[model samples]
Target chain A: DVKVTQSSRYLVKRTGEKVFLECVQDMDHENMFWYRQDPGLGLRLIYFSYDVKMKEKGDIPEGYSVSREKKERFSLILESASTNQTSMYLCASRTGGVETQYFGPGTRLLVL
Target chain B: AQSVTQPDIHITVSEGASLELRCNYSYGATPYLFWYVQSPGQGLQLLLKYFSGDTLVQGIKGFEAEFKRSQSSFNLRKPSVHWSDAAEYFCAVNGGATNKLIFGTGTLLAVQP
Candidate 1:
């Protein structure tokens, strides 16, 4: 079974603070993604990494960035957290050419 | 551009009743379809996927989905509903051009006793 784990399940931060959400996968997948889920809006991709140090912006990449220094770890960074950035963040990973993605328990971020 | 649409936003069903969730897609050719379930405060879990060869695909938790090429639909069905099955279900499609997947808004299911 594939396992994807997030660093924090819930987090609270003040406005203008920097927030980091970490995700790790044991399956050694080549593609990792970061998404923010909102009510009635579904899961919108924030950023994705195909390989180490290679990143691409998804549909909604503003106010968010990602890092993939290693194959197993992917981190999402908020340069300046704002209240609007508060949402349930999810991380998913899959190998190349595979359509199925395994997801980690989301991180619910609260920017006050 | 490829897109997925899940028409029903919320559905309520009694236990032991049959359930169906509709999903439709817009793409140039046959696309990979998937149904995912997300429990409250948890990540999404893959229920089933339809790539090719099989129109009706079975998934975990007694769930199944059928892909209809004529209608561009991949709807999920379950013979019996359980109270624990209450969750938000999302429909997604991969167009095969890229690794990205387009997801539907999602349908929240409520199971009645």
Candidate 2:
């Protein structure tokens, strides 16, 4: 079984503070993704990394960025956390040519 | 552009009753369809997937989904609903050569005792 683990299950930060959400996968999948989920809006992609040091912006990438320094770890960074940035953040990893993605238990972020 | 739509936002079903959640997609070619379940405060879990060959695919927790090419629909169904089955269900589609998945606005299911 593929196991994706997130660094934090819940977090709270003040406005304008920097926030980091970490994700690690044991399967060494080539693709890693960061998504923010909201009510009635579903899961919207924030950023994705296809390989180490390679990143692409997804649909909603305005206030978010990503880092993939190693093969097994992906991190999402918020330059300046705002109240609107509070959301349930999910991390997923999948191998190339496979459509199935395994997800980690999400981090519920609260930016006050 | 490929998109997925889940019409029903919330559904209520009694325990031991039948349940169905609708999903429709718009893609140019054959699409990869998936149904995922998210429990409260948890990440999404893959319930089932439809790539090819089989129209009706079985998934974990006694759930199943059928893909109808004619209608562009991949609806999920369960013969008997349990209280523990209450969760938010999402439908997603992967079309073309992209690894990205377009997810639908999820449907929250409520199981009554």
Any runs in candidate 2 off by more than 4 Å, and if so which? none
Best by DockQ: 1
Q: Name the lDDT value of residue B81 in candidate 1.
A: 98
Residue-level lDDT tens digits of model 1 in B1-113: 88999999999999999999999999888788999999999999999999999799999999999999999999999999999999999999987556588999999999999
lDDT of each: 0.94, 0.95
DockQ, candidate 2, comes to 0.82
Clashes of each: 0, 0
What lDDT is obtained when candidate 1 is compared to the true structure?
Answer: 0.94
Predicted candidate 2 versus true structure: per-residue lDDT over A43-87, tens digit per residue: 999999889999999999998888999999999999999999999
Lowest lDDT 10-residue stretch of candidate 1 chain B? B93-102
In model 2, residue pairs whose N, Cα or C atoms come closer than 3 Å (at least 3 residues apart or on different chains), thus clashing, are none
Per-residue accuracy of model 1 over A8-110 as CA lDDT, tens digit each: 9999999999989999999989999999999999999999999899999999999998999999999999999999999999999999664699999999999
